[model samples]
Target chain A: MLSCEQATRLTSERQERSLTLRENTELKMHLFICSGCREFGRQMDALRSLIRRQPGDKPPED
Target chain B: MIPDSDIADLRRDMLAFARLQISDPHLAEDAVQEALAGALKNAAAFARKASLKTWVFAILRNKIADLLRSKYREPVTTTDPDCKHCAPADDQYFDDNGHWQQDTQPRSWGDTHWLADNADFWKVFDACLNDLPAEQARVFMMREFIELTGPEICATLELSSSNLHVLLHRARLRLRACLSGQWFGTEESA
Candidate 1:
């Protein structure tokens, strides 16, 4: 089982790399039972969405 | 075929991206103009597979690179190893067993979409972004707002994946903590 710290790190790591099956399973299992990290993940996603919708700036076509 | 209006739009987007990379407004404008000029010069070589916007943006990315290289050629002082976010944290959330500490567990910030309706939210956001240790802010903007690929950012900034991810992680954590305080209801003063 991944620790809260490790799971949090995985949250940001998802931005740069896709987790492997084992890594994904650990993260999902930890998140399923951990409300704080789950809430933290929700906030992170919401933050990204808001940052994406920031006016006058579209996602650079990459 | 290049339309003058299309050039104008390209310049606008290019300028926006350049402004994030370069501090001086004049320098940003010059970079954008120089990029457009280069694109126009190579107009015949354009494969037409990429959108005009993408083509122009790729050109502008190079232009920004050129300006950074020429205008600031010295060893970079901005990406300090010991900077706040770049350094390892003193207190981590997990104990020896890698489980959560009650005190360090993250707290929730309820529906934060009010940020869209409130223009001032951006003001707070900008301030918070600026408050981040300089290196972290640069990495965050390049990776997120400026939309550089991980490899591209690594090449431009000379960071390995692990180093870059650390900077990005710190940036997100710092920014989220700031928003949770100033924008959400968790501010210490509140």
Candidate 2:
């Protein structure tokens, strides 16, 4: 089982790149049982959207 | 024709972003000015595939790069091996067994959609972003704000792919902690 520490790291990294199949499975299995890591993942998604929506100055298009 | 107010806003945004990369305010101002000028000169050739803002920022990015190269001898600082601020904060949340420390477990943030229009919330968000260490902030902005690809960032900053990933991950984790503690987990302070 992936530790919360490892799970959270993958959670953060999921923002930057596609995880390997093993990583994705491991993260999914851990998050299924770990509310803390699940909440951590949701927060990561929230932060991404919030930062992107920041008013006044918009980031450049990809 | 883009209104003067819109141009002024873009200039302000460019200057703010430039100042983060270049220490001198005057130099940052000059770079933004030159970028706007260049964008105007080539306005005819601006293919509409990208938003005008994106095109403008692309020009500004190159302008800042030139200035950094000429003045600092490197367009962007590469990773520092022993930099104290660049160290990861993972230990703060996890114990020796790699489980989350009891006090540091993630908390539910409740509804977040309402925050989209909350100006005060943005203030806290900006503060958290600004509080990031310099290198982490740069990479985070490059990846998240500037929308650069991982490979593009590695090329631009001369970072290994692994290093870029680590910096970006660290930045996200820190920002998550800051936002949760300051806004989501507590009653509105702003």
Indicate which candidate wins on TM-score. Answer: 2
Which residue pairs in candidate 2 collide?
none
- What class would a CAPRI assessor give candidate 1's docking? acceptable
lDDT of 1 by residue, B67-163 (tens): 6656644543355354443666423445777665565456777777766546588779878898888778888877765566776666666666777
DockQ numbers for every candidate?
0.36, 0.40
Interface RMSD of 1: 6.5
All-Cα superposition RMSD per candidate? 8.1, 6.1
TM-score for chain A as predicted in candidate 2: 0.86
Q: Give one digit per residue, the lDDT tens place, for model 2 in B75-123.
A: 4456655444456565776799888677777788987877866768867
Docking quality level of the chain pair in candidate 2: acceptable
- Which 10 consecutive residues of model 2 chain B have the lowest summed lDDT? B43-52
Which residue pairs collide in model 1, if any? Answer: none
Report the C-alpha displacement of residue A20, candidate 2, in angstroms: 1.4
| Per-model TM-score versus the true fold | 0.65, 0.70
